[model samples]
Target chain A: MNTQTIPPLAPDAPVVLEMTNISKSFGAVTALVDVSIRLRQGEVLALVGDNGAGKSTLIKILSGFHQPDTGTIVSQGKEVRFASPRDARAHGIETVYQDLALIGDLSVFHNMFLGREYHKRVLGLNLLDNRKMREQAQLYLDTLGISIPSVNSTVDLLSGGQRQCIAVARSIYSSPKILVLDEPLAALGVRESAHVLGLIQNLRQQRQVSVILIVHNYNQIFEVCDRINFLHSGEIALDASTADTSEEELIRIVKSGLGRKAIDAAAAQVRPGPA
Target chain B: MPPTAIQPTKKNAVGVKVPRTMREQLLILLSRYREASIAVVAIVLVIYFQLGSDGGFLSPSFMSVVLRDTGRLGLIATAEVMLMITGEIDLSLSAIFSIAPYIMALLSVTYGVPLAVGAVIGVLIGILVGAINGIVTVRFKVPSLITTVGTLFFLQGIVVSIYNSQPIVAPVEQPFNAIFGQSLYQPTDALLSWHGVTAFTPFLWALLVVLVLALVLNRTTFGLHTIATGSNIIGAREIGVRTDRMKIYNFMIAGGCAAFAGIINTAQFTSADPQAGSPFLTLQAIAAAVIGGTSLLGGSGTVIGALIGAFVVASLNNGLVMIGAQATVSDIYLGAAIIAAMILSIQVDRLRTRRRV
Candidate 1:
């Protein structure tokens, strides 16, 4: 309803990744239609939308869980196709999915280095460098100001906030160019959510890592995000800078996408139309 | 600032510890030493058998026999635990165990191939069968239980039809019998033997395999990926873990272990019984793992636990026979042992989870 005022890209800001004319369909249900979004280096972009607004589908496509029916993805100005999650990761794109980012049964250090374990060569056998991993895990958590009993503690035994912190920390360990997190704060308590929001802000400012975060909370979007992309009915309904938008405006835009049906219902009631 | 940095001095929320109840303390103690609890139960059973049996079950010779059987079963269970933790099951392992030795015997005896080379080829075939099971389950999107069950029957049928329900026998020769199936230190003179003094043949192999696998599971990247993939498949995939490949590799390892077990049995007896290890053997191996504290649901297991569990099963089997129990009764006892182990593990897991909360 309001004019979209996306901030102009800075001259020195390089484009990290661009998904152009992306469209995908699952059977007869069109999930995404001609959606285009670009991430600039060192920017925290927030993707916010109501349920079934194709937010997850877009995230899945970016994370290489699902391929777009029609689209071209350019990473660092080079054309690329991610056939699998490994391919996406190879291009320095890491995604931490919500809820199950870390193995619950594994210790914090083990989860932190799940696929990429540190091993020392001993008698030609690749044995785990557990001491090194444990120390590094402690250092990373300490640097992030996360307090847990120990790195050897299983993640399932940890609080919801601590588990989330470990997941975020693990993603950052890869030094990825673009980190995509799908609903990192969902189901967390208010205080836990605040902690995660702070972690995101710290990541953006200190690490200078580009992020594409999907979240339902508008307050979180406003607090830590630089840019916002709103999806309504399989399309980018609003794309703007956080400085140019407010919570009231976001709610209004979200409501207006379904406003036509509401208006039709109101007219039907006023005119006393037959059921 | 992060929430931790703020350190909100909320009244009554900081470091107020309450004394734990007696039950809580007991649960913590039990869960922390669940393996030790199982080991205690196993030791009691051995003592019970030693007292009841006509022959001294605790005698050095008899104990050695029991350990040798335990070792063979333990090796297979160790392999199964790995697959189970990956959220997959391999029923065809017992089938592979039964048939691989026959293949080795046929190659060595009929084809006049080197015994060692034949054994190696047999084990490789077993690995191939496991790979097929993994590929079908992962690539074709079939449940592993179903895929492995189908493979079990298929392999079993091949072995039965080819061998015509006949046992294949080979001559007991030097080196072949010396390395596997037989005792580690053979007696030169009857008066002063050191067979049990060192280690039994198959048990040594079992111990070696168990130790190596335990290391691989706990101290390697493969182990990390295994736990990750088993714990959360979607989470692992999101982190770029190649879970399908990991499962396939695990299946192959399991198959190879079964083959090794089969070779040990064949070398020990100097015969390859086409129907040696049945579906019952598979059940025994799984029962051993479950008793050892490996979860059926996946993502949590240990080789040490499986090894202990195998000892428990071996004790039950050997004890029953020594106590003059009917052959059918031994099966009943095994079934009961499995149920008991499952109950114990479930309780231990419940306590551990409760402690977390």
Candidate 2:
């Protein structure tokens, strides 16, 4: 497997958000146990694990879809709590679930402005401001360099890659501080996955954004993200910079349980210090 | 092909490139050409009846009666289409239609209640029944089709037992008849006699109701939310849209329209028949919606399509009678016409899609 050369992050790079010792369970099944990850501004962080490694559970917690049983979420150095997904949105946290991120029946513009619609009063009725919305939707897509046949086209007519791009564009449009993407490249082909990776990279450069991407593609992780956090058996078994690791190393750590010493050594190498 | 190689614009007569407006582009791209094809079929059917019946079908008196029938059927279909667009079905709507007028008659004639107040009571009962349907479906997590079927029989039974399956005559001197049944002017000649029969009042009321509903569905935020909900319930909930409330509101609108239709019937005929709202009405409403291009599976529909659908149905029945077809033959003809319209629309859609591809 090809690996990108290591480039150490600036020692003083700021942490935008931190999840500390987060643990959660469902009745008799423990999904996540004492797993924590930190995200930095202007960086793409990959959250990697096998199926049932509690990656989704951790993401759902951050998105406020599921409350953690035990943890403290510190955003910009202040402890906070989210009551619902809407509440999380108010705090500049957005998530794109694998499915249901966009409604296919609606037009691209409509999906772009879903839940936050612009309206004008006509005869005491609040009617959609279609002109303004259309203009703004075009502007948003243009900024992302996503050219489509028409903004008025229903999403149902778009390709799978285009649909995912629209969902990503909508999440980025809100100018959220942290964007949580769940398995964005799972259902995509190689070219489409590369297209989405390019879009994510563009997003990092264009805004003061932090991304937590749940991906199974190691090539994508090395190509796009700054750091990789390997989750194993409901815990963070390996958290290291993507540049400092190899695909084989990640594979072994994922396929077989990592020893305590190996995990510590890998974690220590990527710790906050000059390498 | 490279993205830059495709140019969608066309030059106009003045040698200036005119950008296609969103409206025009939408018309070009709309996937549901069923409405347009259905409309063409409707026009052709009208001409066919006029020719087949030797001008009897187009006679003002017959056309006027057909229009009145179209109004009632159109209103019911409108309500059904809206509800269907929200991804639910209401079988109890026919029962609501049957019971509403009787409630008005019982209140005003038997209990000495005022006519206006009684009408309000009647409409309120429709809404109450709708609320029941909504709650039973949403709160209990029951499939709407099954829940509504149960309510259909239950409400029918209640109406039958209350009125003892007997028809109630609406008093002619009452104000209810004056507003709902009043003819605009008396007909003096055969050509003008169509208006004289009932003043086209019911059809006018139906047109107004459909226009208002079409506005509500197309021009308002509620309509967008409804489409979103029907398209994907989970997606809608994720965006904080209260889908339950949308469904319930649709149910109330349907029930209210059915009640209004009942009042219109009482006004036109000056009588409330206990057996007025039959299961056949439910089938007719569904048929109109489907024939008009409303998807039975939900997520997409149009009110104008339902209107046209209702007209086609009314015309079919009226034309069949005017052509002197036997009752059984007329039923078969109506069934065959609906099937043919649906097939024609499908074929037209396939052709358009093929050309586009």
Candidate 3:
């Protein structure tokens, strides 16, 4: 890997997101412990780990879906604790899960404006302002560069790519400070994945939005991320600038942890065979 | 707009809505007004048949009978429509309806209480029955159809055991009897009676209640929530909507309505029959709501449509009887109509979805 200057986590960097010494446990299972990371303004942080490496647990804690047993999360230098997902959202942190939480039968406008729908005065006060919601959904889709047969169209009729775009657009339209995408490109086709990657790049370049992308593929990380955070054994094994580390070093740390285990030698197959 | 600001986009690449075909438009129109059409057809057919077969079918006495008949079934149908919209079926309502009069009879005859107090006690019995239904479904998570059916039989048995299958009657005073036991139209039983006019009963009250509920269901936020919770419970819950509470309330409403229907029936006859309203529990509701274009799946139904649907069902029965037809024949016709409406609703939903494509 080419050697380049890796920016240090400093107060002068204008950090948008900061997590210090976060630890979480679910009953007897220790999901994450002593994890700390910093995200600068307009930077994408790629979080990669194996299946049981507590990626989901960490995301849940950050997004306020799960409370960390021992940790303090600070947003923009202010100590913050989220009691619920809504609370996290209030602080401009949003997580778009794999399911997308989109209903199939409802119109796009209805789905987008759910829980907080704009209402118009009807004959004084007793009617729905459906026109406003429809127009608002239109404006959002326009901003996201998405096309469909009117905002009245049921989301089920939209393509998989369109649905993901809808989810992304819905989160970002409200101008969330940090957009947490969970496996966004996982089940998408080549075309859909390309569209999503383009969207991510645009979000960073054009909108200057910060992303905390949870992905399994290291190629995706190297392609789009400014920094890579490697998690193993419920802890941050390595957090380095993408330019300062190769894929080889990541493999080395993951394999070394497995080599010490006494179980049926499964780590050799996953990392690589002895050469 | 600034040059850097993103511009609006089109819904389709073609930049046009896929206009609904004429045939498709017709079908959509038919579906929207299917209940109304059914109701109109039923009314015309009833009058035509009454004219052909019975000389007295269009008479004032016959008209009064129709109102009395429609009132009992209309109230029951209202209960069913409300319950069904919440994805629940209350079979116990039939039994509750059957014994509500007994509650009044027991209060008045056995306890020597005033008739007004007896009537109040009877309505309370209705409230209690609804509460039981709500509790069972909420606590056990068992499907309401099964729970309600079990309660139906249990309540029926209790009624029969208490009443010995005999009708109970108590001496009600002039004013109490007048309000509950007479019809609004032709206030006196005999128009040219020598005695003072006795007020009409039951029918107007049922109609008023149905009209008010229709307003409540259509013109209120509660109505919108009802459809939302019924159609997509998970979606509603995700938005912090209290869905379980809505269902529990719906159960209570249906129960209370059924009891009121029973009270109305007892008032009309001034007697208590333990077996009253036994068969009409699900049937009347199914008929009214389905006829009114209310999706049996819940999420989509109108109170006005349900009321109209009730009239259609009532007319079908009344019309058949006026034509000297048997109840069996009417049942067969109603069954066919139910199947047709279900098919129509399914088609309408498909067309709506296809419009997006």
Candidate 4:
């Protein structure tokens, strides 16, 4: 895999979100154990793992879909608790699930303004300001450099890449401080994946939006992500900056189920840095 | 880019720009609007009936009958359109319709309650039943079809047992009938009088209801949320849409509309029948909604389309009679028309999809 070289975040960049020793379980099955991750401001952190590696569990916890059995989450400088997805959203955390959460029968603008619709009172009745929404949706898409036929076009007609981009754009439009994306490109072709990657890169440049991207492809991680966190057996086995890691090492670590100690040794060999 | 800058343009093979012909343009427009296709069907039926009946179908008296039929069916179908868009169906709406008018007549004649007040109470009962259906289906996670079917039989039984399979005549001196269902005007000579085009009060009420609902569905946030709920319940809930409330509200609206339709029926005939709301009436409402391009599967529909669908169904019944067809033959033709309309709509949907590609 070809790794693209991008500027690394400053070492002194403040952490915007921190999850410490998070653990969760379902009935008798342990989905996550002592998992922790940190997100820096304006950084794209790729969370990579095989299927059933507890990546979804961790993401759901952060997005307020599931509660961690043990742990605390700190946003900015203060500890916070999310009781529901809406609560998490209110605290500036937005998640775009794999399904995109888009109503396929609705138009693009309608999907963009799904939950937060604009309204104008006419004859004492609050009617949807469709014209305003259409204009704003078009403006937002254009500003993000996303292209589609029309805002009025129904979402189902769009390609997978377009849909994924729309989902991301919607999250960004809400101006969330941290955006969590779950397997956004899992169903896209090579070209479509490239389209989404380009969108992520563009978003990083355009705003101070922090991202937690859950993906399976190493190439995608190297292409747009600033850092990588590898989950193995419900724990984060590897956490390193992309600048100090190689695809061969990542592949080896992922394939062998190497624990955090081995990854620390490997990371140390590549770069002697404070543990 | 500005919203208007992104006009939909067609590209053919090799990515060359292709200007569409007038016929193709019209077809594309028709495909975009679900109501347009049904509107075309209604118009064609009208012209055919006018010619087949040697202009007699266009007579004011005959037109009055068609309008009245359309109005009653349209009211029920409008309610169905709202409920269906939320991925719910109210089979009990017919039962509500049957019982509401009986309750009104019972209160007005038996208890000597004010006619207007009794009518309002009757409609409220319909709303209450609808809320119950909504609550049971949503809270218990019961399939709406099963819940509504249960209510349907339960309410029907109540109507039959209470009224004892008898009919009650509405008070002839009640002036509320004039506003609800009495004819406003009739053409004296029947020479295409526009003033008497829509003489039936029920037709007028249907027209008013359809226009208001069309506005609500197309222009209101609640309508959009309703569409979202029907389109994807999980997605809607994720966005904090309170989808259960939306479903309940739609049910209430369905019940209210159905009850109003029953009241109109009572007003028009000046009587309330214990066996008024039959399964056939429920089927006709569903049929009207479907023929007007509303999907039974939900997520997409138009109120205007439902009204036009009712018109098509009513016109076929009226025209078939005017042409001297037997009742059984007319039933066959109506069934065939429903199937044909469904097929045509599906084809149009395919055409739209292909054109987009």
* Top lDDT model: 4
The sequence of per-residue lDDT tens digits that candidate 2 reaches over residues B232-282 is 877776666678888999888899998888878876777777778897887
> DockQ for each of the predicted structures, in order?
0.40, 0.34, 0.18, 0.42
TM-score of each: 0.90, 0.86, 0.72, 0.88
* lDDT by residue (tens digit), candidate 4, B1-357: 113433455222121223377765765776678788788888898999899899988777787788888988999999999999999998998899889999999998988997688789989999999999999999999999999999999999999999688999988443576678765356473434443543577888998999999899889888998999998888777766779999999999999999999998888788889788897888888889989988877788888899998988898877988888875677797798788877877776676656553
Query: Alpha carbon lDDT of residue B355, candidate 2?
Result: 38
The Cα error of candidate 1 at residue B177, in Å, is 0.4
| Candidate 2, residue A148: how far the Cα is off, in Å | 0.6
The alpha-carbon deviation from the true structure for residue A46 of candidate 4, after best TM-score superposition, in angstroms, is 1.3
Residue B200 lDDT (model 2): 70
- Model 1, B153-239: lDDT tens digits are 999999888869898886646677867776433334232444343447688788899999888888888888887778888787777
**Candidates sorted by DockQ, descending order?**
4, 1, 2, 3
* Position B40, candidate 4: lDDT: 81
True lDDT of residue A148, candidate 2: 65
Worst 10 residues of 4 chain A by lDDT: A266-275
Clashing pairs in 3: A148-B11, B182-B200, B182-B201, B183-B200, B183-B201, B184-B200
Ranking by lDDT: 4, 1, 2, 3
TM-score, chain A, candidate 4: 0.91
- Which stretches in model 2 have alpha-carbon errors above 4 Å? A1-43, A66-84, A186-195, A257-275, B1-32, B172-175, B181-198, B337-357
lDDT of 1 by residue, A74-175 (tens): 999999998988788889888887755788878999888877778899899988899999999989888877667668867877766678778888887888
At residue A181, candidate 1 shows an lDDT of 85
- RMSD to native, candidate 1: 5.7
lDDT (Cα, 0-100) at A205 in candidate 2: 68
